[model samples]
Target chain A: MSAQPVPLVPVLAVVGIGLIGGSFAAALRRAGQVGRVLGVGRRQASLDRALALGLIDEVVDLEQAARRADLILLATPVGAMRAALEALGPHLRPEALVTDAGSTKADVAAIARAALGERLRQFLPGHPIAGSEMTGPEAAHPALYHGRKVVLTPLAETPVRARDWLTRVWEACGAHVLLMDAERHDRVLASISHLPHLLAAAYMAQVSREGDADLRLSLAGTGFRDFTRIAAGSAEVWRDIFLSNRESVLDELAAFERVLGELRKTLEDPDPRALEAFLEQAALARRLWDGRSAMT
Target chain B: MSAQPVPLVPVLAVVGIGLIGGSFAAALRRAGQVGRVLGVGRRQASLDRALALGLIDEVVDLEQAARRADLILLATPVGAMRAALEALGPHLRPEALVTDAGSTKADVAAIARAALGERLRQFLPGHPIAGSEMTGPEAAHPALYHGRKVVLTPLAETPVRARDWLTRVWEACGAHVLLMDAERHDRVLASISHLPHLLAAAYMAQVSREGDADLRLSLAGTGFRDFTRIAAGSAEVWRDIFLSNRESVLDELAAFERVLGELRKTLEDPDPRALEAFLEQAALARRLWDGRSAMT
Candidate 1:
């Protein structure tokens, strides 16, 4: 980074312009850092929404955007990143720096390296710790990444030039970037992010069955609302993460099951002291975290 | 009953004036529904705060307040409800319509019936669908019950005159009242409210112990934040509820574990059709309920 800010880039290409991608384009445009923003997506409606919402200056073909762009941002779902890379791999300009907003890093980085080898050194795999239950172009918000942490998982072979440029881009997009290894990134997300989703879905499904089964859901307050709210999110998106990050998620899930089993035993024995201790520790840990800042 | 809006009751006693009771006192005073709101609590600090915050006009002895007041609202923890009722049982005036904010209803109503039979006709065991993670007198808010449901688990033997008077009181507090049998009330809450808490706490306990847990927690965004938020709430309050309403809560927990076990098996295999069906069913049920409004 320079002591003085660099001049605004002229053009930027956002591949797979969904919620994250669309929001990136909108935020950059709103910041007036990019003279022209181009969005690339398979769906015409998504491209239209991106253009209409002023998220981008134009809808450009993937290859055209890749060739003309000063930077390329991958904002597709994690499962789609590999296929997206295959399409953009050959056309990616040598001068252009590539980065992604996929949640998982190991698979994306590995796929990029396998597809483009030395050229992949230019690609930076990053996950922004910001999102909502809502998805796609309509849900995009400019302030989504403001004051939020963005994690970049870079390989040992990753180019210093690319990393610097990528950091600058994220900072311009109003994110505080942290860099870590791909395996570590995957492990962390599996425990905190992926496991929560699985737990919510499984738990919610228990109450969701049809019957004269007693449910005072009408009387559920904000606590219950907030807790189970994510259970209603996109299942396909969660399924993709769970399947792709299976090993890490499974490891975390097993850890969780063990804790739950212990809790179950404690409950059975009516150990008030043990139960209270468990709850107090959790409350303390949660209280130490900043309440206003959204935990991603 | 008066032909006009029943003349505002002058003397109101808030029994067990902790979080909800203090807030109720404040709301009543703010709305000018009561001239002298008496607060009864076992704690001195809470009584002091209630007086300082102007939640009550006076801090009085429970029996003394019961003798003087036209209305009594119980806001104690579920476990303390029976003890509170037993202490105040003989002193409750025939004209004073009693209600509560306890989570569980069956036991409270049963205890009221057994201990204060004729006066039990005056007791309307109610559960207000309002709360925050924060507790005690300080966390009290006037708007907590706004747009939320207040379930009146009126027993079969509850007198029509008393039930009507109790309904008027709940209405004055800005709650939408719904009548249901006590048993059904417990069952419903077990599924919608209690089950979700168990799931969230169990999941939080499970995932937070793994390697790289801190890193994963750092990456957990809004999704994880909302999901685990209730896990940070008062452990004493929840633990008491679980123990007090053990039968219903345990039954719900068993149901949840069974469902989760099924999901675990499904995850072990990649049966797309079955998983999609499971997700679709859950999504449909969620959509059927009003987003956040249904929660209260």
Candidate 2:
């Protein structure tokens, strides 16, 4: 179904004003689709920075912001999302549309379902597949979501109005929106995004534990740098992601391990042809994927 | 001991005129430190391209080129080094200083010792820690090795004159030369370079074999791109590397598996604190290493 036309939101409340939240607020403000944006977070300094950068018009308490908002965007970590929803629950206007920008959709959906109770229809779970190896308000930019995919997992109980408004808002921010079930969204992301992050972290940890790690680090060049760049992401953030999406992440890890096992066996047996074939398959697949990505 | 001052070499022969060899020829030519560079390869078209690009002055056969050279550079794959060295053996001039740009030094060293026989003293196994996912003479650039590390794994029987001349030549090309034993060089590279390449290949292979691979690939972002960039390298070249350095690469793979096993257990057990700590350690280590690399 096509998204219905929605007018400018009177007031938008963005909780957890870090990279994702700040970027959303900035994008909305730049598009002139939000009359005023209110930033809410535990960190006063972060909220103040967001306001100063014009990402938001003002910093306000969560409950107060919820009361004033025509729409509320939950942009906290999935782990912190439950508490934010609970605190905003009582203060939320009866007609307010609620949405989130979390990585793991299933967990966030469950949390929202439990906390929002009767207001579940207002909650739309979204994940903007956009970011850098960066965080905080300083790292936020208006174009962060431009030309990126933003998947929305709207519950069966979700109102059509809420889903359509959220879609229109993300589209205004230059995001290409796709709709999917929470479970499928989580599984797909686990395979592509989460698994790669954990692998990079594990590789880095392995190298750091080496006897001659210092020497190895010295010899690391551009290849190593690119491969492990995601390992340098915030620990607190990734930890939440790994745990929240543990099941799917574990499945992907198991699949990767199996492939690695096959490769290890080939290496041990010294099968030149098999090894070459395996590497060739991977190289060809990656090149094809890269070509398609560049085109899109 | 210090490197001795060496005059311009009258003739230099570069076998396997691909990325590494072509770049070396171009750099030496740009520095005006060599009178003439002869390109030797199985592909006449590649050698002709090198000559046309001014990377070499002429194209010749291995034996013919070896006989006319004051210096010989074996710049082929590690697997091909043995055959190349054997072919150049009978035609080598007595005073010719020989070096290589192989990825795995231990394998190259063993091959050199076996094929060069009495002339092993003139052979220095070298690896220029510089390359791109691209290969071939067309990808060659004079500045490819500038400010890059060039590791030379000199054998015990290697003559000081051979080592000195090779070191000076690489220095003229703007590479910082470091000396180490072949075993140590291989082990260090296995930990840093080879291990990461195998990991990237494994990850790419895993994703490619997935049921919904196209979907997963569409969801991939910059993180996946950077992580798998090396996986797009020449399959023939990397396969040889993996096989030639099988022992060391397997050791690294085992170590990585152990770390991954621990991470998996932690994930299964649902330990948020433990998981956070693990991610934190890796992030800290990667950041510190990146800081040092940037400074250098």
Candidate 3:
């Protein structure tokens, strides 16, 4: 497989032309891995902006783009996946490969199963673990996904050829592709990605609602700034994610609350040894992770 | 007061020569504002390290150092403040100015009042809003407090001369000094610094205790890194902080729990508009804070 030459995608349709979609189109165009990149979105102004920025070669309707394309990249929010799949279902080419950049994979897989039916074999569910606080076509950059992890959760019905092709494409855009079960992907993401986001949001909401919020914010420094950075992400995008992966997110939240309660008890009772031990364990784990991540 | 010329201390003693104490000594030395810097700590090895690093001119016992010094800086943890003050109280020079670099001011003020009695008038409680994950004598740098905020929570019994002298000293080290009530300082810190630290520790405890912790940590990226970075802080240090300001921390913890419960409800009920509104408020607040903080 490594020795085989990968063929260029004759035509690529990128739905939702925002940060993820725009970055993907820009990267592929920069690599010259696609013949023509067609951007599809509900907003004509956004599509026009993406075209003007040279992120896409043309703007086309979902049906027309899907009918002419050899590949379709669904980069919309998780809530829009079902409708997007439905719109492309009738005109989707038999040989076209479909993939997505949604945060939640299980829901995307389920939506693909319901909407694509037999065409599900050609669909590969993926999520690139790269983003910024900024969104839209203007925020798009060719190096956004460079040196990032792009996870693929292929359905049981998905073809080996389709998965291999999608892996090659993501590699061309400078991402390392890893394959995992959809359920496992969602659970892993809930612990690392979804949980941190919710915790930051909760912290921001708490601080902002305080009686001395202005004073508190004025005193907040670098630590507060970095910790709440993700809480400033796209609200519409994150809300859709929270609802889409509700069960996993709730499980993680409960785990976090239980630990918080334990910490509160330690603080209230003033157990120096116990509190030190708990904090030491956490600090050790974080340091170990930091050391290992730097190497990898 | 602003027109007054700041007097140079003939001899200065810095108790507990860790990051805060070491940095203070180094910055004063760099500014050429002190005659001789005396380092005080239980550990001779740490004092030797500070002396070798040129952070202090010599090592001396706390009582002897306090008796000979024109100024004293207590840079130990809040838990150690009472014992530190008690040791210095009997031998402290009558004309000496004293201050502390504790994170929580109310407890430190109470400790000083109880320990120093008549000497409390010379003790001005302060907290420098500057630190790194790094600690100890080796981590000390001359520019550590440059462009930072140093908050002073002076007691009603504190002498105006002592407060003014301490403010001038901090300003000489390139810090902006602000004065507030001790109770207000604890509350504001609880909302910003203390609360964020607890949340990060809790999140880290939850994730590290999971059965698939290795996998979860491996998948963790920049967001997770930034969110949990403070969790890697000194265990003994934070444990002391949490216990020192327990009431204010508990109040902030309860507030965070309430907001988190609201977010969980929105997730469970699947209200797009409600979820978006909550997230939008948080995002807007963070962005606004970021903009204002950058300007300041």
Instruction: Output the better candidate (2/3) by TM-score.
Output: 2
Ranking by DockQ: 2, 3, 1
Give one digit per residue, the lDDT tens place, for model 1 in A102-150.
8788888888888677787768889888887677888988887888888
| DockQ of each candidate relative to the true complex | 0.58, 0.86, 0.77
Can you give the TM-score per candidate against the true fold? 0.89, 0.95, 0.92
Candidate rank order under TM-score: 2, 3, 1
Candidate 3 lDDT (Cα, 0 to 1): 0.88
Clashing pairs in 1: A188-B216, A220-B295, A256-B206, A295-B220, A295-B221, A296-B219, A296-B220, A296-B221
Candidate 1 residue-wise lDDT, B1-296, digit = tens? 23434346678888766668887777766666776788888898888987887788788987887788888888877676677777677887767777888888887887787767566677789988787666788878777666778889877777887787777666777878888898888888877787677667777766555555566566667787788887777789778777667688777778877887777665677666666666666665555554545454
Top of the candidates by DockQ: 2
Kindly give the number of clashing pairs for every candidate: 8, 0, 0
**How much RMSD separates candidate 3 from the native structure?**
3.4
Provide the lowest-lDDT 10-residue window in model 2 chain B: B1-10
Q: Give the TM-score of candidate 3.
A: 0.92
CAPRI quality level assigned to candidate 2 from its DockQ score: high
Which residue segments of model 3 deviate by more than 4 Å? A1-8, A29-32, A42-53, B1-7, B30-32, B43-45
lDDT of 3 by residue, B160-207 (tens): 888888888898899889999999999999889988988898889899
